[model samples]
Target chain A: MGIIDKVRKVSETVWEIPVTYKEGMRAPARIIATEKLVREITAVMDFQSAASRQWMWA
Target chain B: MDVGVGGVISPGGIGFDINCGMRLVITNLTSDDVRPYLKEIVDLLFQRVPAGVGSHGFLKISRQEFREVVEQGARWCVEHDYGWEEDLELTEESGCISGADAAKISERAIDRGYNQIGTLGGGNHYLEVQVARPEDVRDKELAAKFGITIPNQIVVMFHCGSRGFGHQVATDYLQIFLKVMESKYGIKVLDRELACAPFESPEGRDYFAAMKCGLNMSFANRQVILHRIREVFSEVFGRSAEDLGMRMIYDVAHNTAKLEKHTVDGKEKRLLVHRKGATRAFGPGQEEVAAPYRDIGQPVIIGGSMETGSYLLVGTSSGDQTFFSTAHGSGRTMSRTKARKLWHGKQLQRDLEARGIYIRSTSWAGLAEEAGAAYKDIDEVIEATELAGISKPVVRFTPIGNVKG
Candidate 1:
């Protein structure tokens, strides 16, 4: 499922992904962003996380 | 979300450039007064403030003094006559986060940081001269209160950080954290970069103290840069910085994790807020808000890409939802590499100069990478922040001169 589908809107600008989305999750991840910014922030975050993984074990 | 005393501290959370931040200085000169010397001013600033990769500063201090600088922060700069005493009053945390231990910083970090004070690093970092147009005043009362008086009032804004010193600090800690995160703490993560140690753990505490040194180093760096700016302007205008009304509006850090008191579940809790790519927008009446702005709110300087413009905003009482935080800047929508490929630095410089914005940079590649088009619409970002009630825009600053790194 997509991140937007996983996150439940908390407010007009805030979104939260429940801990149940992934195993070993301690708490929900709260993001403060507009609908448009969500795309930008998530895209960069995904790229960074993937690159971080490669750097970590390389 | 109570980190309480047992929260985990992630070096990744704060990023590599420990206290990458912004500082805005207001001046009494109007745009017309500065327009005549815009090129000269930008040229002198480009000369005085070292920029680009591996840039060293003019400050000459031994290892012992550098140790004291990290420990004392901007206060050391003030004591040494680099800035006015009032500058600290307007700075967040009085320009120094307490509990920074010099000994916590590695020698490698010291070697990198010792001479980097007052230097601007490359990649989206810049020293800009902006004008607060009369038409751009959103809140006239608040704008006047923040020192942006008169039409087309000139102000200097710069974005920089702890330089190589902070990078070394992060590198040193990231290596240590990676080793102990899983073996010592048994804390596994989705990504290895999420490596963290308990707040009270020896590694965590040491990193926290070391990070504060990075914070202080950045603060001191900006303070000295301000000093250079004041000198450059004084020479060009033949007036003292004070006589020219060069008062600092505020200085804020973008990458940091701080232990702060907040209301969670209607109960007071100490949370370790990791504000990466975010800024603290403490509301009015918060004790942490500077005294001059206590009746209003903390001045949040949202720096836009040099091509467009930036904004001066005030925190809102309604900012409690996201732990009283807001976006740091019009974040990059395009990668630096992608941007460099799309635009040439020299061409971009000529394009900006044609649009009435003076520009100078160490490299055209760096300049092109920071082309305004590469970032999100700053107006839209500010609108989002205001609509979300995190911060209220007071005035917008249009750049007339910029020294890009």
Candidate 2:
């Protein structure tokens, strides 16, 4: 499973997206209830993470 | 949320605009006095106080002067003749936070804030001329102490923050922490957005120092805006700000983390109190509260949605469980984009105007985005807040005239 599946949600309000999901992601990404407010924020983070990983590989 | 000492200090937790807050200025003028020249007054305020995105402010300070603003905060504005000396005493942190090392601020940060002082940045943030609705004053003694004895007494409240400078500071630090989180600190976070170092660590120390600069910058920003607001009032009323009793009620940051001493287990303990979208609701007898209001309590301004009336509340001793903190405002029930889709700015503007509330804005679309329906009912929220024993309402301020850009 890729990084998205590594999410370990502690509760409804908190979840941890682990480093194994994305390379060089030094830390996990925690999503609180507020993160669900706008999909755009998570989308931007995903795009940035992918771009940064590509750059690191390049 | 408790950020462990020397633990991670998340920029996300502290918020991007570090000390983004509100300022309340009291005036002796009444609704009757302002009714005659409401349009002219709001128009003059709109002309004087720059609002909206990419707005330039009055003071064009050099890089060095910018550093002074970060170091001295609102005191810098007072020293430069933008504010009076007494204003500082009424402000949270006395209008300045010490340990703000401007050196922690980047050249990029300086450039972003160099000319933005005195400008009210966009969205939700506004400059409103409100009148104390007589019947809404809960604690008559507290209201009187806050100079709100007379019904329809005028007051001005403006909300803004460190603007681009604070944004850049948060961005820069997040990157630095992300790079150093594992290597230097041997610390891992639950999220990259929660990137932080130990408070005692070099990175943590630097972040706090830089964050303090953002706090200071916000105070300076509000001070300059208040100066401009005073100018507008003075221009319209044909009286000096002093004669108009345009004194500061209080200024408090809704986003900030401070090392404050609070009682725990019946013993005073120092805690790294970080309040994002929350404010300090210090009860009576806290030495930090200004002398004039020391016996009363710290003033807490809860900004309701633009249409609904805002409130002036004071902390309660019962709020100790909350670390003397309370909700900053009525949280949004809907998104801005969604609100814009549901309401037309022109129609909303007309509807508000018909209610005797005169408002000026640069973008009607932005105005629509701040529709009253977008937020939770402020009255209900305030009732819940007081019922929670966090704070007690003092005076209800209904917006009569407001300016936005």
Candidate 3:
């Protein structure tokens, strides 16, 4: 499954993927976006792999 | 998200352009007052403010002075008469983060950025003139406090960053981190761009100090640009910026990681907040907020595509859920390459002009890349942030004039 598939809705405008989704992740990754935004964001380019990787916990 | 004090510091988290930010300036003039000269104002601004890729600033300063510029940030600009002293207070971190150390910067970075102040770089960077219609004010009292009292009030907003200097800083440190991440630090990363060092490590501390230089440089750049904007308005309207009521609303950086104290599980601890494509949105009564806005909240400027409009928002106490951070802009829905293929810049310009927006661009291709359809709906993003209680909208500003880099 893609990163988007693993993303769980945390709030009306927030979504998250736990550390289990990707190895080496120190903490869960969160996105502050609406459902529409989340869909659009994840479907575009390499956001699921490359760009989303950059969004990992610092 | 809170990267606790003991957490790592990733240069990638801050992005290439350190301290990329938005600045809003409110003017006493109304849309009616500026309508007659919209084209003239945009043309003059385009000519005066350097824009586009590799654009050099008009200012001539020695390398030593450039070091001071990066270290002191906007304060250096005000000291050199490029801005008003009061402009500093309205800026984030009073326009100068205290920890910036020019000594930590690479010589190569210095060479790239020393002459880049007062410039708007290419790729989605722009200077726009907007107006706040009476109906656009979501909160009349709040909007009035932000200098949007009169109907159709004119305001100037711009988005840019530390230019090449910031990029070089990130590049320099990324390479160093790559060398040390696995070998010396025993840290593994998925991508090279994700290279990082421990926050307490020497390499990380050095990068942090160097990054501050880039942060300060961006503030200085915006300060100088604001000065030029004031000059252009004065020249065109035949009145001083002060007489024209051209005062700054606020300057907020969207990128950069900083150490901040926050309560987690009922204990206050320092967390290194890394806000990439996100903005700090401290709510009311925050001591870090400017004195004038401390009672209300820090002003947040959200830039939309040139074709659509932008927003003036304020932070909310409820933003603590995300460490007091909010979305930076209408995140792109389509890639620049795809957008360029979809829109013709010349035709887009004409269409926008017919709708009462005047635009000047450095390149047609660049202009096409920033087409409104290229980005997600800004109104939707604002509504989401509002529903999430991260930020509260004060007013919306429609673009009347724009200079795209």
Candidate 4:
């Protein structure tokens, strides 16, 4: 699965990426950003691969 | 939010103000003494001390002198006769934080800071002439030790920071890390805006060094402003500031990251502690607390809005668990936009004057955004911190005259 597919919403303005969605993960990572901001956030974040994915957490 | 080891240092962690913090000075003169010339004193201070966004400062120094300001911090101002030598001793880190490398700072940062020294940048920063009451004196000896001899002891308190210099430094480093974080280090971030490098990485070391310059710049900035306050008082009172017994109580910075030694699990460890809105409140007997104040603990200044009052607090032993830190100011209860929507600046200014609070601000809209009601009650915040055993209250100062940016 793509990194974006692993994203989940925990609350408004907060998103979580579950540990099970990725290898060698111990805990989920959370951020203070909305789903819409997720794409805008990646223009610089996805330096290793060219990718885009959108998943509805709500 | 804890950033892990080798994690990047985001400019957002400390914000643009850098070492933006508060400085409190206690005077021998009483409210009665100043009230007669209160208007004149405030007016002169408002003129002598520059406020507002992007305002130029009084001192016009050479580029070499400017570099010294960053390298020597507050000491640069004192050596140049800006403030008394005693003022330096009372200030944390003696106004100079080691590890500051002016060479590490970007040229753009230099340009922004060169003419902006000694200024109170816009957005809620202020210099106020206040009166402390005896009724609110939490510890009489502590207050006395702090040079507050009586109720109505006229005091001057101001809040400011590194100004545009720090803003430029944060911007420069953030951009640098954004480019190198994933490419060179293979680091993945939770937020794109939260770009950072390892604390020991080449990028991290350079940023840290640059950050120290920003801290020192803030120290020098406040030291110069304090000197101006003394000058204004000396002129208004017809005596030297020293003759008036006007001396600095203390100065504290609320932002920045410091590598400090702390005891954990009964073992001493050094950790990089970053406090954005919190300040060092080292309790009594701690070596880091200033010399004269070592027995009493570090001074914790909690600045409130114009209408509300501010407090002077001392660190306590019980606060060690939280790295001996406490709140820096009366936390905002309403956002700036919300407060502006609630009231007009002109009306708020008139209302504050009616209540005996004199205000001189660069912009009325800026003043409205800083409405006292928009902040958490300072008295209550102090009370809670005291009850929580993090800090002990020293004195409560109500503003009589204010100058804001």
lDDT of 1 by residue, B103-189 (tens): 998898999989899999898789999999999999999998988878999999999999999999888998999999889988888
Best of the candidates, TM-score: 3
Clashing pairs in 2: A3-A21, B6-B198, B6-B199, B52-B405
Residue pairs in clash, model 3: none
Best by DockQ: 3
Per-residue lDDT tens digits for candidate 3, residues B1-405, read: 344544788888899999999999999999999999999999999988899989999888888999999999999999999999999999999999988999999899999998889999999899999999988999999988887899899999999999999999999999999999999989887778888888888998999899999999999999999999999999999999999999999999977999899999999988888888889999999999988999999999999999899999999999899899988889788888888999999999999999999999999999999999998999998998999999999999999999999
**lDDT at position B15, candidate 1:** 83
DockQ values for all predictions?
A: 0.27, 0.05, 0.59, 0.04
Tens digits of lDDT, candidate 3, A1-58: 4557878898878888777866767677777777887777667634545544535431
Query: Which segments of model 3 are wrong by more than 4 Å?
Result: A1-4, A45-48, A51-58, B1-5
Rank the models by DockQ, top first: 3, 1, 2, 4
True interface contacts reproduced by each model, as a fraction? 0.17, 0.00, 0.62, 0.00
Docking class of 3: medium
Best first by lDDT, ranked = 3, 1, 4, 2
List the lowest-lDDT window of 10 residues for candidate 4 chain B.
Answer: B1-10
